[model samples]
Target: MSTNLFSGARKALVASIATAVLLGGVTLVTTPYAAASTTVAAVSVSAKINAFTNIDWLNGVWRTGAGFSIPATAANQAAFKAGASVRLADGQVRTISRQQIVGANMSIFLDGAKLDGNKVGAPQVVTIGSSVVTAPVTSPTTVTAHSTSINAFTNTDWLNGVWRKSPGFSIPANDANKAAFKVGASVKLADGQVRKVTQVQVVGANMSVYLDGAAVNGSVVGAPNKLSTAGTTTATPAPAPTSPTTSVIATSNLNNFTNNDWLNGMFRASAGFSIQASSANVAAFKAGALVRLADGQTRKVLRQQVVGSNMSVFLEGAAINGTSLGYPKTVSVVSTSASTPSSPALTTPPATVTPAPAPSAPDTTNGKPLLVGVNLSGAGFGPSVVPGTHGTNYTYPAESYYKKYADLGMPLVRLPFLWERIQPKLGTPLNTVELARLKQSLDFAQKHNVKVILDLHNYYRYFGKLIGSNEVPISSFAAVWKQIVQEVVNHPAVEGYGLMNEPHSTNGLWPQAALAAAQAIRTVDSKRWIYVAGDRWSSAFHWPHYNTQLISNPWMRDPKNNLVYEAHMYIDKDFSGNYFDKNEQFDPMIGVNRVKPFVDWLKQNKLRGYIGEHGIPDFSPSALVATDNLMSYLRQNCIPSTYWAAGPWWGEYALSLDVTSGKHRPQLPVLQKHAKTAHSCTSIGPL
Candidate 1:
């Protein structure tokens, strides 16, 4: 909900070079434009974060539980240091942290993690986030022929996983009736069955084909069979198209593209993506619209098409360059005169052309902004199965607990990982069991299309001493962070790391040491958002000095820098709670009277912060009053907050509400009411 925040110095770049543009063969570059203009807000919006102007990634402070993006540019450092929202993209005009947005010169969000785009060898390694190669700008279309081709076959529709172009789509298919395949162009098959043709049996002069050594239907390549891909048997009847035509998964959004000197595809060298088209696809594209993004040249729009919830755009076909078949084409999309277009994917993009234009500089969505997220441990629930099916650790009701949270439409989730169970021993490292469980959980997050924060929960020690031991040595802490970085950092649903659960410390050294540990992570993992406890009792107002380094550290540089200083909002006990004492009771004025101070202080220092911990007690629905008050306060101030937990606890505590109890407790209604609002909390809904 709360993403990039930038305020301050304006970035002025002369993207135009004062030289004659290069024109190869029929391709010609367009004149550059160096102008600025404001237009009506478009229905399509994008946010982009970058590393420029020597920016600071995490500088904004927490207002209630929300974080503001601040500027940290050198020229605007003073103003950014003073705390002011300069300007962020997507009409985002909010004050951010000094380290994040230097007076509006930068922004921060948990989008990418552990980026590695360098080429090591055959597999061009690109870690962190999902990589998209933009080429052959697709012109949206109404033609379902391509879709119908695959839809026409279910079990026979090739493999049941993602299909990628092998060594480019240029490889000609043995089937003369079908068009040539493109390089690297892949499709995901939902259900594909393997067939085996071994024992040949004659049934009254009739023959059937066997799949996986079992005959399902009488089928085989009719007529004189081709030599390459073998299979000869009785021809089977064509299957009726059960689903809609066309089998292509609509992946029109191109963010970062690279390949080709052709103006056919899309690729964004600077930020986001750029699109162009293949030469052959371009000629075909002329039937629709043809244009290229100045940044990337990966696509060309071929036809206008409609897709998604309620969006319409030109549909474009992607065929890698130099990938085509000389065989007579059966697919009507291609022209006969065409030498058979080659596959669209090149070895590496055609050449590093200009990148795609940065998505309207990363900024938060407009209107009164409030982020909602769920904690799986308290307010939500998954399956409460008996025994652990996969992982070696004992299974509880937690998995079933998540079902309720997902139903409640919780947008953000903080799923806890019991360290004692994950790493029962001290020196022994993570194994395949833990890996599989983590993968399954992450897969759940992705399937549900929600954000999840990996929560490490436990009281364990590494290197012979507990985590918060003397000075909290950096080396020991790094070990903990390294595991997370390697294991789950790249998962799309995973936003970033939550260092410790209900984190605390009496000595001041722990916070600084943790800060250092985070900084070390920054050295390798650049684009992840990190949540660390504030200080002492995990309160934002606790250690002013320790919190200062997060703002004043040397490593706090880069538009991708994402660090969040977290604090607990529990007015009572941690997991189990009675209810807030009269002192911290429900107050309609909490946002203004209490939470405002925290916001104002964050504004003053320009630091990003969050309320990472808190929840209601068991059997005490009255706690809803305080929860609503706190939630209301956050909404009023644009603070993003996550509820205490998701999974239901049978324990008799006020803060530990079970989502699946189905009794509709008092707080359930309160939470339900808020769920209707876009800015309401999402950490405590149905699984």
Candidate 2:
């Protein structure tokens, strides 16, 4: 059978043809994908006889104004439809397949007869039939029937092939989840009640399931009841409540977190945390376990502390965008109903789990925070010029710039450099000139006690080909990382190796490729942290959509447990650092809202996180507020962040923190204020 080769854009407009169109007896089972843009139900069209001439060969189906029948079996039909050889009247034979259909520009005749073998004429095409199917309206909280694929224990996002493995759970993509969770293809629930996916949210790791715009009672979908205030399933018994009581949970100075065992770890809170516990949860909490809070938040109870006096109670979950907002002013104990005789009324558990006070904290200059840093740019510019002249096409950060930021109270520097400039050839030794320039920067950082994270800002591609693709094999990618690790494994200023800066379109191979690169680094240096960025530009907002495999246990294994996931976010209109609009308005909460997904994912996986890059343009005052808010949020959660940039060449760049005309940029004061509060970095452990 002949077919019209539609362009990718035109293909989206084509829908399934319900009725069988007999073209020499070939049956069109289904179209490529149904049109989802329309809300009206699609109407099917009756079959009609059509014909055409001149045909292409060995690339796709080849026929001219003729009809043919394919084999009845699925396998036979696929093979026959794939390609077939036919003889022309001139004794020339041509094979047909689906490769060269691009730009074929063939036409179909509305009325024609089945041609006998060897009848050749101008190249002809037969446009496939299309009919739209009923689809639901698309809205902020509601998804179309064509887009609803999530079920009780699974979601449409997990099945999108971008994630190679599952996290053993599925949650809808809502404003809270922000993995940019998209249920792109069509799927149906076993109950058939999920015709249209309505509102559902993933706050932290807990998911509130919904179906057809109605709340689901139990953890399972299609349940026949609503959730009660007790936060129990309809099948489970309610717990007994006591009363809301006040207690002096902690009385020590508020600044005592310096050596606190819990606060030393990332995302760990010292006080202002409580959960309505079940019997199992109570046992888990008392044993210093990771308990899921009644409100669907999760935290590992490493230790609980009480150190203050006359602490009035605030019986509410203290969280910012679903993360532990550190140290509430007062502590309160709210009584909770017990589900069983063994379960006690919800009260503050005894603080018996505290381990020995953390070892002497790392040396700090005036007790400056560990992760306050600036992104040192320059080496990564001029992507089109490979192995270009250093001074003209690209340049490394000036030695003085490192000391300037370090002396200005920034203790860390993220150095971005091109991979091609470093190696010149893939899988080869580092270029000596580039290597020397990098070492010089490291030396300057060491002199000023400033940590450095080397960023490979390649955007998951080298010479325009994505890593893990045929042109750039994962082995080559891993090899380069291994060599770089070997060189700086002993450098005192080297904080860690950023595997890649904002990897995008890695074709779902990011998890595998990152793991391979990390394993290679471990072969030389296992103590230092390796920052693994997620696919799709390492976007914190879209972390869940493309990075489930990286978080999935055993999918990405680092033997040393020193892996820190890196994510990037921007508060501009497009989430890109380059603010095209001079006067972009923004909500002060934009920064907090965008990074919540990555932070929540980190907390859920019990892993540390780093914001490798985030910045705001100077054009908008709201941008400054958003920046300050983001820094505050990061500080509260103990997540490290580096501003987008500071380089000698960035003379007029809005986000650049480079000192120009000896004047401080508008963002400097805000950054310095937050930098002073940083007392910890990813380097809490050895190396």
Indicate the TM-score of model 2: 0.49
Kindly report which residue stretches of model 1 are placed more than 4 angstroms away from their true locations once superposed.
1-370, 378-400, 424-428, 458-464, 468-472, 541-559, 572-585, 590-594, 617-623, 659-661, 679-687
How well is each residue in 494-577 modelled by candidate 1, as lDDT tens digits?
Answer: 766777654443344555556666776666677667766554445443435435554555444222456555655544422223
lDDT of 2 by residue, 624-667 (tens): 65676677677767777888778767655567776354443557
Using Cα atoms with residue i matched to residue i, what is each candidate's TM-score against the true structure? 0.41, 0.49
Looking at model 1, which ten-residue stretch has the lowest summed lDDT?
3-12
Best by lDDT: 2
lDDT against true structure, model 1: 0.36
Give residue 247's lDDT in candidate 2 (0 to 100). Answer: 25
